[model samples]
Target: MDIHGRQLQSAKQHQVFVNFRGDELRFGFVSHLVEALQRHQINVFIDKLERIGEDLTNLFVRIEESTIALVIFSRRYTESRWCLDELVKINQLTDQGLLKVIPIFFKVEPVTVKQLRGAFGDQFRDREWEYRCDKPRTERWRDALASVSCKIGLTFEKKSNESEFVKIIVKEVKKMVQPQENYVVVPFPGIRRRRDTSSHGRQCQEEQVVLSRESAVLVQENSKIANQIAVVSMRYMDIESENSVIRAQLGELSERLQSLNSIIEVVEGVVGKVPEIPEFLMNPWQIMSTSSQPITASADMFYYP
Candidate 1:
């Protein structure tokens, strides 16, 4: 995949926009995050360039155009005046429902961002004093932070490993954006042709092509089904052959048992002992059909047939 081309397309396509301070995170955490997102085909616009006063308009346009914004609030995040300005614009887009903001508190507590405490508080104080002349403008930045801090977002703690934290972030981003490649879209030949049709003559020709393509597809599908049936039939034949062998073995064992019984009866007769013959050997069907006493051998019994 052409990552640079896709990133450019994404800038116009407005997939996901990332807002972060370059000084603290550009070479480290934010760079890794952008790379991970891009690997998944999730186009990202990482804010790595310096934001000049003249470029603020274009920057705001980019933020407004995006569908989702990722604002990484790091320790030195509040220190950048331009970063604060971007945050306010992002918040504005979020409030208007035009954009979705996902805040990432990197090694900083959400409350610290909300209340402007900890290192963030100290930086904001310095900026407040630096821009003390413009109290209202500074106040807007503080409000933006507070509002963004209250939002639901991912957090990377100081004790947590960066690589694992990035994976979790990417997973969450995937859930939110749900990249197109993750889904299967089966297009109908006719409908697809209709979409590509430019003129009446072209439409008719395309329709013919679509019909032929659909016919070929249907034939292929049927061939697959027939092959599957053939495989199943072969398996069934093998099972039937195995069953025939088992039955033949059982028949041989039954014949051997009958012969052994006949020899024992002959020995009993020679010894002047009458041996009882089971009714089943004589007539098993009769025993099943009628509820009567089974016929047995007696000393006077004789067969003259």
Candidate 2:
């Protein structure tokens, strides 16, 4: 499907996965950007893998198929091995022309990124010490950052606030998409004559027929992918629902167990405080209490007593 003039190349209908290091503000900012994209009818796939697990490799695989990656470059971001690994994979994918990476530098200087200094420096310190030299390591890091800067637009600012960052990012994406409105359709070469030659007209008709068939096929493929995504989403929802039910049941069971324990404790305390009594006769206290109650016994009760 095409939006405006730009082809919506995603196979899944409403999916975009966002991968970010564990920065609350960064995640919120990306979520806002996603909302903006959704407003434009773009499907986003978001990976909340942090909640699920910390296996960076698994996370990388999840990110590999995404159309675009938005990286939030904070001071702490470089410190995370998973984040760095993700960046490396992104760099690889971008080099292979498979995906686009957008870098949003939050409160981190471009110089710091370029130099791999400070937090970045610390992250790579082990490797640097392994090589027994800092200069080569720093140079390679600078080159990598420079390449990333050239390939992916980097926004460096002091503000780490999510809302402000989202606004800036949305504006930038808007500008990028603005020029694509005109590229949607290229007009067929203008025909000079009212009627084409018979042979040329037949060829043009055939070409038009072919184009129509291709368009239909593309639409069908898109529909199929959309259905698949829907199914996957539904499955995820079911799993989540099941998990919630299980959790609720577990909570109830825990409460019941606690209540049982409390009851047992109370029973044990009462039993411990009770005085011993002969099996065949009532205790003095019990007999006195019964006598004070103005007992009305039948002939059978008196005989039994």
Candidate 3:
């Protein structure tokens, strides 16, 4: 329920968000798809727009803005952390009903991606070890992979014809991007003409106007509620941030306390072995012989400074 960061604003600009690994899909399959979509006048967003030091917030915004996402799952897709992160975000948007996802498995089986098997499994295992300390993130990545791979999508095998596949994918994308045509049902003209129903029609129109007004009021109320939710989410994020800081500080304090305890133990051990006073330190006029008496556990020499 708590939205943060990019969730502060709504995106209503782009049409399609292409989520793919640049190294594997950029030059070949994704390129062709982008060109085909562009040729058809579709507003497409690809990672090619990404630059050095570009804020990743832009990527999320683009994904949110897009009506549909084309997630091209390639063999090396999981190898790139950015790709995985994008996939997670895409899935999040999809779950929220903010975006539709059409996954395209390229040179990788849907089962392999879903189960993290074959080369996908290999890379995933390596990444798991690499991110062993961040298991939730890894798990989210895996979940995203499973979620997307299970969706109905086009698949391109290693030996599959690229051009033919691109054409099919383009056609599919076109179908998604195209607006649905509204069909009006016309009554048959063979029926006899009825008497004028002006009064009834006027009453129906009046009822429709009342309903429209009520709908508008409901919409406004919903908008207000959404705004209130956003404010609460921001507050929650601030609280979470403060909690994290407090936890970190507490951890530091706990470590410092342990260190102080160890230092105290060392000092105690050294002090417990109370040594006899040196004869040289005794007053010259009042020479004192070394004490033959054993020091007791309650000796004053054991007192701390």
RMSD of each: 26.9, 20.8, 14.5
> Residue 151 deviation, candidate 2, in Å?
3.4
Per-residue lDDT over 1-305 for candidate 1, one digit per residue giving the tens place of the 0 to 100 score: 25643454455556688888889999999899889988998878865542655566577777766778899999998789989998989877665446677899999987777656678878987998999999888867866776677667988899999999999988888877775443322244434222333587566666666776677567546644543454355346548879999999999999999999999889888986765798686887766557667667886677565
Global fold similarity of model 3 (TM-score) = 0.57
Candidate 2 has what TM-score?
0.45
Clashing pairs in 2: 5-184, 15-43, 15-44, 15-45, 16-44, 16-45, 17-45
lDDT of 3 by residue, 207-237 (tens): 6557656765675466445435543553465
Model 2 lDDT tens row, 1-305: 22521332343232345545566544456667777877866555555534565664666656655666666676666545456556666666555445556777667775566445576656655544555654654434333444453434556565556666667766665554354432222124542223345898767656665775677567546644543554355346548879999999999999999999888789879887446677436555565655556767788875753
Please identify which of the two predictions, 1 or 3, would achieve the higher TM-score against the true structure.
Answer: 3
Worst 10 residues of 3 by lDDT: 183-192
TM-scores, all candidates, are 0.53, 0.45, 0.57
lDDT of each: 0.75, 0.57, 0.75
In model 1, which regions exceed 4 Å deviation?
A: 1-12, 49-56, 179-305
Q: Sort the predicted structures by lDDT, highest score first.
A: 1, 3, 2
Better TM-score candidate (2, 3):
3
